[model samples]
Target chain A: MMTATRTKNTTTVELEGDRVVVIARTFRAPPRHVFDAWTKPELVARWWAPKSHGVTVKSIDADVEIGGRYRYVLSHGDNEFAFSGEYVEIDRPGRLVYTQVFEAFPDQPTTITVTFEEEDGLTRMVSREVYASAEARTAALESGMESGMRETMDQLDELVAELAAG
Target chain B: MVETFAALAEPNRFRIVELLRSGPRPVNTIGERLALRQPQVSKHLKVLKAAGLVEVEPRAQQRFYALRPEPLRRLDDWLDRYRQLWDERFDAMDEVLEELTQKEDEG
Candidate 1:
C-alpha cells in the first residue's frame, strides 16, 4: 500500500504503482477556463513560478498543439532552472498529455497527463506523471532536496499548512 | 535520507517497517506476522538499523525493535516540499483562472 499524504486543504499526492505519481486538486472554475490558464503563456506566467517560493518567472513559451514544445524557466536569485517539454496529445478543455524534461536531468523525461472535469462550474484537475522508473521518480521528487533547502521541520510544517490553507 | 529511501525500497523490508509502525515487537513476532524466516528478518533489521530506521531495545530476556522516527520525519518533509512546489503553482493558477473568468464576464 502506498502512503499518500493530503495537504489538509489543497493538493493530494499519491505514489501510484512503481513509476507514477498522481497529484490532484479541484478549483472553483470551468474546465475550459482552467485549460486556458494552463496553455496560455501569459496566464502560465501568472501561476507557474510562484513568488512566495522565492522564484520568479524568467520566460515561458507554450506551443499548445500536438508536436509543439513548451519551455519554462524560473529563477531564484542568481540561479535559474528550466523545464521544457513537447506535447504528445491535446484535447482542449478535457485532457492534455505532454512529455517534460527538466534541464537538470534532461536524459530522463516524465510524461504528464492532465485531465479537467467540471461539475457545477468547478474544475477538478488531476495530473498523472509517469517516470522512467521507480528510482527515477524518487530522484525527480528529491530534486528539491538536492537544491539544499534545509528548513527546520516546524518551519516546514507551518509553511506547508499555510500553503495548503490559503 | 537517500539511504533511508534505498533501505525501504525492498518489499520485504518495507513490510517490516509497516509492521513496526503499530508498535515495537520482537524478531520472532515480526517473522511470524510477516511469514518470513527468523534469519531473513534479522538480515532486514540489520540493514534497517544501519540506515538508522530501526532501533533495538533489550527488554529483559527479549529484544524489542521499533522505528527511529527522525529519518522517517525527514523523508516526510522531503515529500512535503515536492507537494508544496506544485501546490503553490496550483494555488496561483486558481487566481489566474479567477481573473480570466472575471475578464470574460466583463467583456
Candidate 2:
C-alpha cells in the first residue's frame, strides 16, 4: 500500500503504486488566477525552471487548445533541454491533462493531469504524472528530469556520518 | 527508503558508499580500496544501484562508480528535493498568479 508519509511541507510529492508521482502545492490566489498563470505563455516562462538550476528559458510556444501543442526550451550552459507535449483536455480554472515528452526520453511520453481547486480564497493545485513503467519513473527521477540537480559530495558525508552515529 | 537502508546496512556496502564520497572509482579500485573481493564488490554495487544509492559514471574510456547524494537513506528525502525543484517553479508561478489576481481586481 506504500503507507510511509513524511511530514507535510509547502509542497507534497507522493509516489503511488509504482508508476505515478503526485505533486500538490497551494497558492494564495483564486483558481482562475492560478490557472491563467499556467496557460499564459509569458507567465509559464516565469516559472517553468528553477533558478538554482541556472537554466534560462530560451523559448515557449503554445496553442492552448484541444490537441494543441506546447513546447518549452531551456538552456543550461551549452546544453539545451526541451519538453514538448500535446494538450489532451483543458478545463479552464479546474482541470487540464497533457502528455509530456522530454527529448532525453523521446520514446516515453508521460501523461500529466493537473487540477486546481479553490477554498477560502486559496487555490490548491494537484498534478499527477504517470510513467510508462516503474523503471521509467526511476530513470526520470535519477536523471532529475533535468541536469545539475543532485546534491553535493558534502551532503553524502553528512548522510554517512548520521548513519555512523547510530 | 527502506531499500536505501537495507542496501547500506551491510558493512561492506556502507564502506563502499563512504569510499565513493571522495569521487568516482572503477570497480577494481573499489575492490582494492575497500579490501573486498571483486565478487563482493559487484554484489554490493548491484544492491546500491537498485536502491538508487550509486551510479556508473562512465568516462570516455572506462566506467567509474560514484555516490548518488540526493537518493540518500530516506527516499522521501530525495522526493523532497525533487518536489523542491517543483516548489521553486511553483513559487515563481505564485508571482505570476499574484500579478494575474492584481489585474483581475483592478479590472
What is every candidate's C-alpha DockQ against the true complex, given to 2 decimals? 0.42, 0.26
| Residue lDDT tens for model 1, B42-102 | 9999999999999999999999999999998887887776777777788888778768887
- Candidate 1 Cα misplacement greater than 4 A, ranges: A1-9, A16-19, A76-80, A133-139, A143-166, B104-107
lDDT of each: 0.78, 0.73
Interface RMSD of 2: 4.9
Write candidate 1's Cα lDDT for A55-94 as tens digits.
6788999888999999887666666667888999999999
lDDT, candidate 1, equals 0.78
Q: What are the clashing pairs of model 2?
A: none
What would the TM-scores of all predictions be? Answer: 0.77, 0.65
Candidate 2 lDDT at A11 equals 84
Model 1 per-residue lDDT at A164: 17
| Stretches of candidate 2 exceeding 4 Å from the true structure | A1-9, A145-166, B1-72
